[model samples]
Target: MDKNHPKSISLTLAFSLTALIFYLPANFFPFMSIELYGNRNTSTIWGGIVVLVESGSWPIALIVFLASIVIPFFKLAILFYLALTATNGKHLQLKLKLYNITEAIGRWSMLDIFLLAVLVAILKLGPWTTVEPQMGSLLFALVVIFTMVASASFDPNLLKENPNGKVS
Candidate 1:
């Protein structure tokens, strides 16, 4: 198969754009709702991080910020850049390195999802303490999965560079 095929590049771009569409709602809306003794509270991913920081759980806050926010946004930006440059035949080595970085850090971006799953499963104190995922969790998972697909569809071999760093 031709790794430099235009179809593959366009498909990667499409997925990356779709991922970005999902990202806004995912990060801004409530990810989970906690019910305790007839009281309920909803928190978005950012809100959770803020709560963690406010409560002095600096380590967890940092982890969430890096894993959920920084990594995913960086990946999306890199994916868009890669898609644009895939057919340009320039910066081959640099693009390859960026792709490798994206793949390496992809799994880490799912940390928030794992944490939510654990919380929903473990925080089951009947109706007194129930944790449940909301629309934002679904959107967030979709964003992560779509970004993964976008990265996987991209072919690093397509990046070609002349000695002058121009598409040849």
Candidate 2:
């Protein structure tokens, strides 16, 4: 669908901007709150991951950290780079690869959201060990969804070199 088209640039920018906006609150707010034995505590995404690591669940901790923090930031960076190059009509050889990777891994970012949802649903201990969704979880979920849409909407053809040795 005219991969190198201007529409692709617009889509990428829109996605990246939305993600960037959400990222701030996602990091600052708590992702989940737990109440146990009359004591209540809230955990941010990093805090949750730290708990997992401290409890000896390294794999899960790593996965959550990557999906929630690393991947989203990487995706945003890639999209911004792509958008910049696209606007200048500078054909980049790795455009296709970058776009594919962005789209492919976008859904993986949702892993954090899914985990939060599951925890909220399944971990209901009637005020003993309840898991409630936090503001950051909602923002993070929106970032993932918007980024996925943006990546999918981008056109790969924009990365192709023009006949005059120029981009697009």
**Candidate number with greatest lDDT:** 1
lDDT for every model? 0.86, 0.80
Candidate 2 at residue 121, lDDT? 70
In model 1, pairs of residues that clash are 89-160
lDDT at residue 17 of model 1 (Cα atoms): 98
Candidate 1, residues 1-168, lDDT tens digits: the string is 243465778889999999999998999989999998888999998899999999999899999988888889999999999888776666678888998999899878788899988888778846579898999999999999999999889876677655766543
In model 1, where do residues sit more than 4 Å from their true spots?
1-4, 125-127, 160-168
The TM-score between candidate 1 and the true structure equals: 0.89
Query: Cα deviation in Å at residue 97, candidate 2?
Result: 1.1
How many residue pairs clash in model 1? 1
Candidate 1 minimal-lDDT segment of 10 residues: 159-168
